[model samples]
Target chain A: EDQVTQSPEALRLQEGESSSLNCSYTVSGLRGLFWYRQDPGKGPEFLFTLYSAGEEKEKERLKATLTKKESFLHITAPKPEDSATYLCAVQSGTSGTYKYIFGTGTRLKVLA
Target chain B: EAGVTQFPSHSVIEKGQTVTLRCDPISGHDNLYWYRRVMGKEIKFLLHFVKESKQDESGMPNNRFLAERTGGTYSTLKVQPAELEDSGVYFCASSQGLTNEQFFGPGTRLTVL
Candidate 1:
């Protein structure tokens, strides 16, 4: 079965602190891995999509890197506004289906 | 252009009452998807619609949840006789073809009392 697992259920970081959140997955014929950030009382905001192993993407202060079996979302000198729940999802190579299997996100808090 | 949009940003209803949620995907987007995030749980895909066609509905929790995309423009998800476990945030997303990036709307927070 295809599944996604995110570690470090919750993290409290000092402002400007750098840390990484992990997203491990078990899927057959991986198609894509996605990173999303969700704030309280809001839906998820798209961050990045990594298609193949060794692929990487970045936006502002966030970087996402993908490997054969997992992905990492590295926050560089995060600010308090960067505090949000980071989510990970994977789409398999299943034909004709666009559904995404998600992980229980990692809640991040960057205290100022 | 405006991003995806959902109706009823928040709704609190009795367990047995019915509620309808709506979503308007970005214009020209052929792919519209529905998802939900239960309390303390990850966001889950409920269904996907491709231009008024049900491409996938495998993730819908039960029969009480009904989703439809009429005229290939906007969509609606009606939960008849909602249950307590149905409390969650219903989100709508849309994407252009050949791309995996889905833009989301401010979800509908459903609370069943």
Candidate 2:
């Protein structure tokens, strides 16, 4: 069964603090890994998509890195505005579908 | 781009009652999807529609949860005789195609009392 597990269910950091959230997955055939940021009362916003191992993508203060077994979302000097639930999802290439398996998000709270 | 839009931001209904949620995808998006996140749970896929066709409905929980995409445009999800477990945030998203990214709408929070 394909599954995704994220570590540190919740994390708190001060403004300008750097940290990383981990997402480990077990899937039949990995097609892509997606990262999203969700605010309190809204749907998630797309962040980055990593296709293969060693692949990396960046946007503003966020960086996503993918590997064979896991992916990392590195936050660089995150500000309070960056506080949100970070979600990691994976699409199985074997399925050839848009049905993505999502991980229970990591709730990040950045305080100023 | 209008992104995705859903109607009735919140709905509070009684168990055994019926409720319908609507979603209007961005114009020109061929793929529309429905997902739900129960309290404390990760958002899970419910179904997918490619234009007016039901591309994938495997993720739907049961027959009581009916989804329709008419005219290859807006879609609707209806829960007949809703259950207490149906309480959660239902999200609607749309993508241009297989390679394009999905755009989400502010979800509709369903509360069954």
Candidate 3:
């Protein structure tokens, strides 16, 4: 079975703090890894998609990097407004169904 | 363009009651998806619709759940005789095509008492 696991169920950071969230996966073939930010009572917003190893994408204070067995969402000098639950998901290559297996997510709280 | 939208942002019902959640995908989007997140659990795929066709429904839990996307515009998910375990936030998402980024709605929070 394909599975995605995210670490640090909850993280509390001070303003300007930098940290990284981990998403490890085990699957037959990896098609894509996705990162999303979800606010309370709202749907998840897409952030980045990593398709292969050593690939990295960034936006604002957030950066996403992928490796052979895991993906990292790095937050640099984050602000309070950036506090939200960060979710990671993976799509398998053979599913052909476009189904995404998501992790439990990392809840981040940025304080001033 | 308006992102995916879902109706009845929150619904509270007793066990055995039926609830229907609606989703309006972005205009011209051909790929629509339904996902749910149980409390403290990961969000999971329920089904996928390509236009008006049921492209994939392997994630459906049981026959008690019925999903339809008639005419390829709006979609509905009906839970009959809902059980306590069915309580969760149901999310609707859409994308233009395969490999296209999916846009999600605020979600419908369903609570079965």
| Tens-digit lDDT string for candidate 3 (A5-108) | 99999999999999999999998778789999999999999999999999999999999999999999999999999999999988775544777888999999
lDDT of each: 0.92, 0.92, 0.93
DockQ of 1: 0.74
Listed per model in order, the count of residue pairs whose N, CA or C atoms clash below 3 Å is 0, 0, 0
Model 3 over residues B1-113: C-alpha lDDT tens digits? 78899999999999999999999999999999999999989999999999999988998899989999989999999999899999999999998876666789999999999
lDDT of 1 by residue, B26-100 (tens): 999999999999988888999999999999999999999999999999999999999999999999999886346
Interface RMSD of each: 1.4, 1.4, 1.2
Error of 1 at A78 (Å): 1.3
TM-score of 1: 0.96
**Docking quality (DockQ) for each candidate:** 0.74, 0.71, 0.78
Q: Candidate 1 chain B — worst ten consecutive residues by lDDT sum?
A: B94-103
Show model 3 residue runs off by greater than 4 Å.
Answer: none
The C-alpha stretches of model 2 lying farther than 4 A from their native spots are: A93-96
In candidate 3, residue A72 scores what lDDT? 96
lDDT of 2 by residue, A1-112 (tens): 8999997899999999999999999998787899999999999899998989999999999999999999999999999999999999887744436568899999999999
